[model samples]
Target: MNVRARPFIPAALAVLIGCTAFTSVQADEVQVAVAANFTAPIQAIASDFEKDTGHKLIAAYGATGQFYTQIKNGAPFEVFLAADDTTPERLEKEGDTVPGSRFTYAIGTLALWSAKEGYIDGTDKALLANQYTHLSIANPKAAPYGLAATQVLAKLDLTDKVKNKIVEGQNITQAYQFVSTGNAELGFVALSQIYKNGKVSDGSAWIVPEAMHDPIRQDAVILKKGENNPAAKALADYLKGPKATAIIKSYGYHL
Candidate 1:
């Protein structure tokens, strides 16, 4: 008697098929509101996160204050990476964020940056010289980094001296752009914006001393809308992990 031949999947092929199916079933997309200052770091982190977790991040970069307003207005954001800890704490208190999901992801540093090489000299000399006609900063009302800039000016007693030359951008990205494009002689921007691999990536910058302004404790939280989104939770956890922390540090943020 002839036996019917059996169709069999090899063990390795079977495991591969199972993993593919598992990833497909578990993969999910999260909508994230990222602070403008964190744009590059988040982009890098998001890429690694997708590859490692098989989850996707759709990020929208803007001022943390604007993100707060949007979230309050019922925007579809599932996670928030804010420029300050206060905003995320407020969101958590207001029930806009998942309980116990908020944490400081990075400590931001302010920088006085100019597109011209060797222009900043890493001190207050250029700012005090009063030669530059235009100085840029983000809108203090809508960005924490902008507020810090104002604070730095106040501490340096240059608020009135530079008031006439101050050019305000809607957000940190625009502030950096103002200087990067030579529309403004210099700008107050996030160190992470111009930093890479532990140094300024381009242009000249003076890393503002932490004592000049309040500690920029950047925080991350899962929003109420993401309460049940595994991808959001996964991302929150990933930010606290080694890979994301390394990326954040490489961009000059303190974890």
Candidate 2:
């Protein structure tokens, strides 16, 4: 009897098919609303997270307050990285987040930064001197960093002295932009915006004292939308991992 020859599957093609199947079943994507101050660190951490966990993170960076409003309005965010603890706490109370999912991810450090090298003397004295024509700050109503900046100014008793010279950005990224673009001579920004590897990446900066304002206890939480999303919980856990912690610290944020 004549036997028909069977078609053979190539090893490489078989392996490729297996990987595609595994990825389709095991990999997932999460939608994250990240605080503007956390943009850099999150971007860095996301790369490693994706590589290690086979999950993808899609992040939108903006003011924490603005994000809160968006979330309340039914934004499809699976995770929230707020610049302050209160917003997440409020969301939890309002039943918008997964219960017991809130935790502090990083303690932010505020900084007075100027794109021009040596423009700031790294002290409150530079602020008290009132030498700059324009000073940029994020809108305190929307950004926790802005609120911290205002508190620092109030503690220094320079709020009135600098009122006329103040320029507002909608978020911390824009606040930094105001100074980086030379539109403002200096600005109050997140240290992570200008810091790298334990030093300011460019320009001059004075890291604000923790005593100057309430601690910026940045919190992360899984929103109700993410209650059943495995990728969302994976990312939340990844943020607490050593790799992400190192990236956060390298950006000048306190863990």
Q: Candidate 1 residues 14-38, lDDT tens each?
A: 9999999998879999999999999
What are the root-mean-square deviations of the candidates from the true structure over C-alphas? Answer: 4.3, 3.8
lDDT of 2 by residue, 1-255 (tens): 999998888999999999999888789999999999999999999999999999999999999999999999999999999999999999999999999999999999999998888778788667778988999999999999999999999998899989999999999999999999999999999999988878888998889999989999999999999998999999999999999999999998888
In candidate 2, where is summed lDDT lowest over 10 consecutive residues?
118-127
- Worst window of 10 by summed lDDT in candidate 1: 196-205
Model 2 CA lDDT for position 182: 97
